[model samples]
Target: MDGLSGQGPAAADRADTAIRAIGLIKDFGDTRAVDGVSLAVPRGTIYGLLGPNGAGKTTTLRMLLGIIDPSSGSRVVLGHDRPIDAAPQIGYLPEERGLYPAMHCREAIAFMGALRGLSLPEGRRRADALLAEHGLGEWARKPIRTLSKGMAQTVQLLGTIVHQPRLIVLDEPFSGLDAINQARLEEMIRTKAREGATVIFSTHVIAHAERLCERIAIIAKGKVAFEGAVDDARAKLRPIVRLRTRNADGPWRSAIPAGTRTSGRDWEFELPESGPEPLLRALIDGGAGIETLAIERPGLHDAFVAIAGDAAAAAMKQEVPQ
Candidate 1:
């Protein structure tokens, strides 16, 4: 089984969900950061919490990790009611970067593992192995300040998993990474999931979620705007049809859906509930010389815009790094 419906370790072993949250809410002073947000993450799968800046992604993650108490609601992590109870089994990389620049690369990783109850010797052994596996063996003794930004970030990530946690949570981990480093991180995430660890991450970058998430929850303005598999979200919107023909007007015009628009020799519109067959037949029967007809499925970005609305989606896009 994967871990979602069960309560304890035995039950979790019999189920497929690893983490489950119900009606989670967080309040600070007067502002409600998270409003009744609930989600279930399947065991051994990658789940994404997607939203724009200040959209409550981080707050929700924090609440789940037991880093902060929620104003209301409940959560189960690794089959335990208290996330802190399962601390040794969870690996987390917060949005903020905090590694001692004065510490050696291997010592830094070993220290992080040691905090999770790993013995110093064992932590150092694991750190050395991890650094070597990630192609940084030569720099294991060098200070963190001496490494490049990407290298430092890589070392920090290695530290996160040094103890081999069953669940990994990363918040905006891609921030400030170049394309190469981002790709490397994506590979690491996949590797963790493939090894039977449940992974949950929060990001404003829809592209990352779209590419890596098996299940995603789109949080907008402190609420869940949409949640499900990527394909299911896209299915909520109609497919688009693009037509290019010699005749843009006349009886052929009738074939275009009522809400569709036409410009010169090009036409574009959503496929109606009746399906594209009717429209195709209408165009052909009207004697319009068909030059090109293409149907395109809605992508995740399009689905995000549809569910989260233009304003929120635009804001998210703006917040994404260039």
Candidate 2:
């Protein structure tokens, strides 16, 4: 709550932005799915939309992509005030997977590229090369129905990138990937960013956003709760100091804060705003022998739980993609 944000893009920022949404809202019948969300994603960077399921992450993405119109507000994608007009240069992979079951993996990838205007022959050549590079050469001729769920997902991801679009939008891309494949996907995102493509991905998984995003917007109750750099998110919570003492009980114990948690000889508490030096001096003057001292900053996971609340944390269940 300390760093809540929904900054609108300034006029001078338009030239460098890959996508800009100002007070986007969507309504399905009487239900308001998204409300007053604003974001400015810079070109050639990775941005993340993070939230629990049913938190309107998908709806916001859909409105931004021109797949659905916003009931209020507006979005601009790749210089097109009308997002659909810029469709040729944008690659989108929706949450639900759909592909022709009988099509061979190679042909399937090429077909996806063709839809984006890549010639079939050129698409096929690029597909083969991409498959080989990604350890899927042998699966090229296999039918989509024959591959396992993980393998099928990989094929779809390959297809998503075959055309090398200027902007790529992926919804819940890591939902079903195992550890290895997830790492591969992370690397692929980095590679795309290095090649100057702007990418936006939505996920409930905070780790992916922490690792890959240059900036992020955290959605809760269909609104932007927090948006900024990952480091900024983590800074909302104060760093904690963990201390170990040689003495079991001493006058120094009185110097500890009221909320300090103790375990055996260790004491942990948040570093006060006045700073840790005063506390350290107090403990030392009280004759406590400091065995170890550590100050640790909160990670994104901790900051997320702090900012989004316990309900959101429980909803994630710390799910590792299957």
Candidate 3:
């Protein structure tokens, strides 16, 4: 296995790597869908590929899954040099969902397992158990068309994992699901990772990545803007201080940072290098009549805006109608 730095993996890390893509590029005519993207997903971890629509997230996933070949670069999946060589050990749920409309839920799931070499009988058994576990026991025998969109999507996901692949890849797995189903899927993802399967999912929704990802790669305009631990991303930006004071012209205003901005009586600014405690004491001592004050640490959303810039983040937000 190769490390993220393009070197041989260390002894302690060799066995922990599940997926590694280095300088992956994909071109469609004049456009480059994925531009020299590189990522390493560790085993038993939930990694997220985050970007707005047309940001090349899907293209990169496809290349990693061997559904499409990259114009250049290399990837290793589950110790295999090529993704197809490790296909049986990988479960992939594409962004575009598809299932036989006339097939029974159990049969559909079993068929998916069969593709990964599970026996029909065992596949059916596992499918039934999985359905029961996911609160769809009664729907096992029902036709796919009979289930709601959420239920069908759930069935598709169950099929993807019925064979217990060592690595699971989901492209836009959260698309179109309501809040409840989204939460359910989140739990399922956590469960899979807990069971020691590496899970990689792509989404434009910052909330999902913030909630579920230990590591994430933020893609913008077909380029990876940031990739690393979620905490590291958030750490790149300073904490914000929001305050509302009755005495807007008080001497304590000097405590505000140089780049501070005001909205009516409210003042919002990044904390200074000296931190917020000094400013708080200054405001109190100067009789600034503070009505409210808060120091907020930046989250993944703020990190995205900071790293990808306001224009790209705005474009991403607008891309997802959800």
Candidate 4:
């Protein structure tokens, strides 16, 4: 099981959900930060809270971690009705990165673990091992001030998981990371999940969520625009069809749907629900000179555009809060 428990079947089943939020809402003074967001994160899986900047991803994460109380609604983490009661079993990395510049890298990690009730000596031991395993062994005694932004972020991430919490919540963990460090962080996330940790992370980059999460919740304007398996998200839109034709105006043009448009030498449209066999047969029978034809699967970005529209799509490019 994902949790460190010896409960029976029924209890184990109850523990299957690492986190659940129902109708969550958070209002900051006059501004409503999050509204009516719900999510069920399965145990031992990588769950992504995906949204553009200022779309409530951070707020929702805060609510889940009990860092902030919701204006209304409820949340459960690690089977605790109150998320705060489950804090010992959770590891959280906030969106804003912070570390004492004077603190050594290993001590910083150990200090974080100590905050979660781990003994300092054990925390330090785990910290040293984690840094070394992630190729930061040489920097063990170095102060946080010496590390680059990416390295500092890495040090903090190592701290987040040093206690090995059952539920790890990271708000935009990919931020401030270079490509190489991003790849390393991804590998670490996968390693933790394989060890039966339930990892929930927020990210505006659809590509990170695309590559890492088994399930994702797409938030837009403080609400969940879509939620389900990543594959389901990709399945929202039909396959795309791209064709290169020798003749643009011909009887075979009838096989092309009305919405199909010409792009350079290619004709592009959504593959009809009935399947491409009929369309291909029609084009062939009509003697359309087909130079090339490609059927493409929709990615998470395309599905986001389909579900949340263009405004939500624009958030994917934003790095700051809304």
TM-score of each: 0.92, 0.93, 0.93, 0.92
**Pairing residues by index, what is the TM-score of model 1?**
0.92
**Model 1 regions more than 4 Å off:** 1-14
Across residues 157-178, which tens digit of lDDT does each residue of candidate 2 receive? Answer: 9999999999999999998888
lDDT of 3 by residue, 93-116 (tens): 999999999999999999999999
Distance (Å) between predicted and true CA of 177, model 3? 1.2
Model 2 steric clash pairs: none
Whole-model Cα lDDT of every candidate shown, in order: 0.90, 0.91, 0.91, 0.89
By lDDT, the better pick of 3 and 4 is 3
Q: Give the least accurate 10-residue stretch of model 3, judged by summed lDDT.
A: 3-12
What's model 4's lDDT at 305?
A: 92
Give candidate 3's error at residue 101 in angstroms: 0.8
- In terms of lDDT, the poorest run of 10 residues in model 4 is 1-10
The residue-level lDDT of candidate 2 at 275 comes to 86
